[model samples]
Target: MKRIMLTLILLVGIGGYTTYAQSELSLQECLKYALTNNQQLARIRMEEDMGRFKTSEVRAKALPQVNASGQYTNNIKKQVLAVPGELIQEPGKTVLLEAGTTHNVTASGTLTQTIYDQSVFTGLKAAKAGEEYYSMQSVQSEETVIYNVTQLYYSTLVSREKMIVLDANIEKISKLVNTTGSQVESGLARKIDLDRMRVNLTNYKTQRTQAQNQYLVQLNQLKQQMGMSMAASIDLPHTSFKEIESKAVGALDFGGVNLDNRIEYRLLKKQEELQEFQKKAYKAEYYPSLALSGNYSYNGISNKFDMFKGSGSTASWYSMAAVSLTLKIPIFDGFARRSRVSQASVTLKELNKQKEETALALNTQFENAKLQVQNNLTTIQAQKENVDLANEVYNSTQNNYNLGLANLTDLLDAETSLTEAQNNYNEALLQYKLAELDIIKSNGNLKSLLN
Candidate 1:
């Protein structure tokens, strides 16, 4: 019984340790985990594999193809042929003879090698380019996942920080409530003052509860983005706001935004390349094709159903073989090739238009991100000053109330203003961080977060 109890205790301890280890995840670790486990990203990887297989299939078309086949037949009702009596040396008489054999077996093998086919060659190129396009698409998908997970992590961190601030405020208010209650009982403070303090304490506690709930909601969302179970518990370090600000301050130093750096632009360019190949493939349809082919077959015929073991004198067997070079000239196809070529041409034109549109959109996003980063930085600086001023005012008010030079109402109001300023600063910090991420992304540096 003691051994059993010890075993149970050990199991619980191990489970706790495992959960704690999993909960201690940094931003980079979370991004890495999501890349490995995300369902959407997994699907994109599967498609990338499919693309490779498709390329192999296209390449196979250019190689020689060999096939073998076999067949067994019973001519249950052979066709009869009418023969002229004179031809058979029987004048004025006709003869009817059965054609073919009662039993037949045949086996054959064939080989076809493509010598030259413009369309096939062009298709192979297109398939290779298509594979490259899928690869680029997979990279684009990874970038997207990284961006989402990072944003959620920052948001959840800010929410948690806000809850921390609320808890601190609640603790301060609770202490003040106790002090005021003691003063009221000893006749050093009024009943009204104590009652007002209690009211403020209640309000702070309520706010703390709301902030806690919001933090949990944001944490759940972060978990979802990381492809983590909703029921899992996670612990993010209390990363100082100053640390985040310091890291983000130099985000713009990544320099100029080049359209080539953006994955979306790169993917579109790859698609355009594939489309060019498609146009060539359609045009190639008008060209002729050449191929080398060979066939070999053996046939056995017997009146008895004994193709495998028939006596040599009772069964007849024959073999046939042939080799040829085939060249096909496309004379006409009722203008089909011409129409398809025109369609491919038009599609290429549309792709070019899309490229132009994408270029414009990319530039717009970069400009917007730059503008937002500048604006958010300015806001953060201003809010930081506000927080400092509020803190100073609260401290002075508290001192005045302690010396009996200020009313309880004034002190409580000062505290409220200070809390408001702190929250505003936190919100500004969040905006700044989000804008910083945008700037990094616009500069095509999201992959840097992986480090």
Candidate 2:
């Protein structure tokens, strides 16, 4: 019984360790997990596989097709044919003759091969191009998933940082409240001043509570983006602000941004190719198609149901074979073919326009992302300075209040400014990170995050 208890304890310990390990994920690991487990990415991969099968299906149309068939019949009532008796030396008399047998059987096989079919060839090409299109589409989807997961990961981190700041402020204000309460008890401070300290402490706690709630919500959102179960407990290990700032600074020195390197542009080019292929398929309808077909058959007849049982005089068997070449020349079909060609041409023209529009849009987005990143970087610097100055002012005001050189009101105002400055700096940092991600995405380097 002691051994059994020991085993149970060991198993429980291992299970707890495994759960702990699963809950700890870094940003890169999170992106990797999402790429492998995301439902949308999996669906797109399946669509790409289906495209390959569809291409094979189209290719099968050009291959030889073979079929076999069999049939049997039993004559319930035999029919009779009228004949002239004079033909059998009977004068001016007619005779009736029974025709057909009581049983019949037939088996046949046919084979067809396409010699020349413009439509089939065109369709094969189009299907192949379609496969390429889906492959590009999958790449685009993966890039998008990476972008979303990275954004959510950073947002969750920022929320947690804000909560940390709020907690620190609450601790600081709680200490002040204690000191002022003692001062009031000794009649060295006004009751109203002590009341003000209690109110400030209360506000700080409230803000901390709100910040904690927001952090939890953002973390849950991040988990959802990573395709993780929300019920599972997870922790994001803290990252230093210095590290983040250094990374952002490094990103500002990127090489020339190329719109053509972007996945969106590549996807658009693939779409255009697919549309061109479609137009070719439509035009191929005007051409003729040629094929070769052959068939072989065996027949049996008998007066009884013994056609396959015996080769007796009452049963007979015969065979037949034939081969032919068939050519289908397209004839007039109420201008349907012409209308299809016109429609396909119009679609191709539209696709070309769309491609141009996408190129321009991508160019604009890249430029805008660059501008935002630079502007946010500047804002981050300014906010950092503001936070430093606010901290200095708050420290000086606290010292003055303690020496009776400043009022309670001035101390509270300085504290408020410090809290606001810190919050704004954190927010600016978050925006800077977001803008940097956007620039990476626009430059078609979002996949670098996985590394």
Best by lDDT: 1
Over the stretch 1-451, how does candidate 1's per-residue lDDT look in tens digits?
0000001112332331223232345678778878876778889999999999999999999999999999999989999999988988998888898999999889999999999999899989899899998899889999999999888887877777777778878888888888988988899889998888888888888888888888778877766776666556665545567764554455545377888989988988888898889888878988899999999999999888877774544668999999999999998899988898888888888888998998898788878877777777777777888889999999999999999999988999999998898888888878877877888888889999988
Candidate 1 residue-wise lDDT at 284: 90
The deviation in Å at residue 147 for candidate 2 is 0.5
Clashing pairs in 2: none
Tell me the deviation in Å of residue 187 in model 2: 2.2
Taking the tens digit of each residue's C-alpha lDDT, what string does model 2 give over 97-163? 8889888899999999999998899889889989998898899989989998888877877787777
Task: Please give the lDDT score for candidate 2.
Answer: 0.80
Candidate 2 lands at a TM-score of 0.90
